[model samples]
Target chain A: MTPEDMDLLAALGRTRAGLKVEADKHYVVESRLAPLARREGYPSIEALVAALRAKREERLIWAVVEALTVNDTAFFRDRATFAFLRETALPELSRRRKDGSVRIWSAACSTGQEIYSLAIAADEARNLEPGVRFEFFASDLSERCLEKAQSGLYTQFEVQRGLPIRLLIKHFENHDETWAISPRIRQAVRWRRINLMSDLSGMGAFDLVMLRNVLPGLDLSVRARLIENLAARLTEDGLLVLGEAESLAGVTEALHPVAGRPGVFARDPAYRAAAA
Target chain B: MKTCLVVDDSRVIRKVARRALEDIGFDIAEAADGMEALAWCRAAMPDAVLLDWNMPVMNGLEFLQRLRQEPGGDAPVVVFCTVENKVENIRLALDHGADEYIMKPFDGEIIAAKFAEAGLL
Candidate 1:
């Protein structure tokens, strides 16, 4: 891409959605926005870049951002993390909290798989606890992802990934072509649109926050703000779960990785915030 | 213990079905095709037969019909396990008197559920 094209795509990505595509990812940008350019009657990529630079079309700009957003997820995407939640976290939380209710938030639930996975775990845990209650809050910046998550329908191929056959029969209704999650599981989660770079007020506190597999791509400033906001919302005893590849050490001093728990972190009582 | 015959052209499927049935406390038997299964049934009756759709010499639907004709064969429960997952295929299998059906590539959990549904567990 020419200097103009690079500046245009980069600026559009940053301004519209706070996305930071590396300079070398022009190929990635070209592939994602190619169809959008064609739809807008641009003769080629060159023509589309020129159009974007000259006058921004609101819809066209959003399409580019949406296309670039990562929604690569599947049911029980990381079995180990879920196993930790099932085997260790839920039981410990149940013991600590006097109240029977537990609140959880999936900070970036792509299509609700992670939330539903948690539901399945919690439902199974009822065998031990008898009647513990669970409330879920799921959020994503993508409206399309939220809609799919709310509907709880998945194709055979989708169900085949990570979702076992036994769970499929128990938790979903099978149509000829697709499977719909049982109404109880589908209705259990509350969905909303939340851009991670945005503020965190008014959402209320959570006992367990699952912000898995989504931190690497963010700019440093956005990451710091989000961590501080998250740290403040998390209760003193609550756990903040990050992706397997993420670390809290350099990211923020307020949160520290809990001992022996691979991805689990908790508020650091001794942390002194950097002087502004 | 109740006896169950696992009928399939593939040895792997027969082994899998045998293991599943055995897990549920059924004495397991194996037959390679519908013809072999019929011959076995004439000799001795099983409590249930986990059957496959396409096999050499005789198919599963034919075996179910032929089994129904035999005096003691009709007593054994029949369940179809096949790649034909369409509703019409399932309806046809059930109409032909197979007690239940499970899709191919199933595990012991699926077998247990389908067996429970068929009242054979």
Candidate 2:
């Protein structure tokens, strides 16, 4: 593909999914989009881009964005994040609420492992405090991911990635070569297909919003907008969880990291005051 | 390097388990059946055991009961690798000192994951 084609693809990534496709990542664009182009009956990626530029097709544009977006995730991806959730977040949220209800949103929960992991943790938490009610909401940019997450079925290789054996045996039913998560765990989360770059005010506030490992690959402006969108959904005392390597520094002042906690964030006191 | 004793009646299963274990950095030792596995353990205890349920001369559960009685036998992480997918069978193995269980048709990834969960990896 030519420089203009690469630029168009990069622009689509940024505008649609907040992904930053640098010029150096031209090969990534080629390799990932190659199969998509072929599947969509285009002779080449250039042809696909030609069609994209000729007429702005929403379906084709989303297909390109989803193809480029990396959905590499596993159960309990960052141990410390879940440790904080179980040890600190759950107890504090349970105590702070008089109604004994807590709502959590797994923003950008790719393929459902993160949400299921959250469900498993929450289920375990309920044993300790029977009165506490946990509501799970998960959204991803890709319809493909949302469908797979909804199915709650995983291959042997998929299940092996970060899932504990005991939990696997407990929550998943083995069906020959595949494992399907129990209905109890599967039905716990409400799944939605949402592009975080768009307005998020329609989605109600969540006590914990998890947008892990998503921002690092996004363009600077997109990162700012996406973080603002996620933070807007957080209740006043709510926490935001990002990937371990991700930080709010220079991204947005809407949320600030909880002191000493690596990826945990809370609505900025200044941001909250301004909103108030 | 950690040592694992792969005890299965089928040589093919033993070979597969051996390659899988070795790939994940385990020094592998193989036995054709429970009796052979017991004899090997008596000489030198392995760090872990990939055990099969059914075999000639002795069975997995029987070997497990006997192994746990021997000195230093408790050191090995005995993981049952078998065609037995029944929950009752798994409970029986765990009740008889098996550390973890993997159903049949397992691959390197499954073994690695089970080993990781067992704290053997």
TM-score of chain A of each: 0.87, 0.92
What is each candidate's DockQ, to 2 decimals?
A: 0.07, 0.31
Residue pairs whose backbone atoms clash in candidate 2? none
RMSD of each: 9.7, 4.2
True contacts kept of each: 0.04, 0.25
What's the interface RMS deviation of candidate 1? 6.8
Q: Which ranges in model 2 have alpha carbons more than 4 Å from their true place?
A: A258-261, A268-276, B8-28, B52-61, B81-92, B102-112
Error of 2 at A258 (Å): 4.2
lDDT of 2 by residue, B1-121 (tens): 9999999999899999999999999999999888999999999999999999999999999999999999998989999999886656767888899988887888987898788778886
Candidate 2 versus the native: TM-score? 0.85
TM of each candidate vs. truth: 0.67, 0.85
Model 1, residue A173: what's the lDDT?
Answer: 77
Residue-level lDDT of model 1, residues B1-121, one tens digit each, is 9999899999999888888889999999899999999998999999899999999999999999999999987799898988776656767887788887777778886687667656775
Candidate 1 regions off by >4 Å? A1-3, A35-48, A127-131, A268-276, B1-121
- Write one digit per residue (lDDT tens) for candidate 2, span A1-276: 898888888888987777889877788889989989999999998899999998798999999999888788999887667877877677777776646789999989889999999999877664235567889999998898999999999986787667765677888887775889999999989999998888899999898998888887788878877778787888888888888877888778888777667888888554333222
Candidate 1's docking class is incorrect
> Ten-residue segment with the worst summed lDDT in candidate 2 chain A?
A267-276
